[model samples]
Target: MVERYAVPDHQWDMIADIVSPPQKMGRPRRDDRLMLNGIFWILCSGAQWRDLPERFGSWKTVYQRFRQWRDDGTFEQVLSRLHLRLRQDGLMDLDTWM
Candidate 1:
C-alpha cells in the first residue's frame, strides 16, 4: 500500500466545509479540494502557483484544479457564501461605509 502523506484533517475539513465537493467524474485518485486549497494558499501568499511546495502535491494539479473551479463558478460560490455568512454574523457590515 502506498503511504499517503496525511494532510491536516482540520484544515481539510474547514476547506471542505466552505466548498462543495467536486463531482467525481475523472481520475478517482485526484483530490480537487486539496488542489484548490494549494492554489488558494499560493494566491494568498502572493506567490506563483508554480512555486507551490511539494507538500501540497503537484503544482500542475493545483493549477489545473484552480482553472477548473474558476470556469465552473465554484470559487465564486464559495466566496459568496463566506461573504454572506460574514455579513450575517455582523463581522462585515456594508452599511458602515454609508
Candidate 2:
C-alpha cells in the first residue's frame, strides 16, 4: 500500500528533477519518490528512522539519503523551487506562509 504521506505524482513531478538529477555513472539510485515518501513519513509522523516502514526500503538507506540531501541543501532548493512554482500558479501566498 502506498504510504499516507507519499508525494503525489503531480507534486513529485515538480521536484523530481531537482531532487534526483541524472546520475553520471555507476549503479542507478533508488527511487526518489519512495525515499521522499519515507522521509516525509518520518518528518510528518515524528517517527524514528528505525521505525520507517519497509515499503520505503531500508531505513539505513533512507537515512543516508536524507543526510546526503541535508548536507547538500537539497531540501532548501526543493522548497524554494516549489514555492516559486506555486506562487506563479497562484496557489500560494508568500505572506501567509511567512
Candidate 3:
C-alpha cells in the first residue's frame, strides 16, 4: 500500500516546478519529492527532526530546506495553488475543512 502520508505523484507534479524550478544552477539539488515526504513524515509523526528516516537523507538538510521554504513563503504559494486546483476540480470544500 502507498504510505498514508506520502505525497502522491499527481500532487507532486503540481508543485514540483514551484518547489524546484528547472532554471536553478549549481550541483543538482537534492530530491525535492524526497525532501517533501520527509517534511510530511515529520509533521504527521510529530517527531523531532533528528528522528527523520535515513531514506530522507540528512535530517539537517531536510530541516534547513523546510526553514527556507517556510521563510520564503514557498509553502504559502504551494498551498494556494493546491487549494485553487482542488477548488476548481470540486474536490475541496473549504467550509468543511474549517
lDDT scores for all predictions? 0.69, 0.91, 0.90
| Lowest-sum lDDT 10-residue window in model 3 | 20-29
Residue pairs with backbone atoms closer than 3 Å in model 3 (clashes): none
Residue 11 lDDT in candidate 1:
42
Q: Rank order by TM-score, top first?
A: 2, 3, 1
- Tell me the TM-score of each prediction against the true structure: 0.67, 0.88, 0.87
In terms of lDDT, the poorest run of 10 residues in model 2 is 1-10
lDDT of 2 at 25: 100
TM-score winner: 2
How much is 19 displaced in model 1, in angstroms? 3.4
Better of 1 and 2 by lDDT: 2
TM-score of 1: 0.67
Can you write out model 3's per-residue Cα lDDT over 1-98, one digit (the tens) per residue?
Answer: 55767888877889988987785578887888889899999999999999999989999999999999999999999999989998999999989966
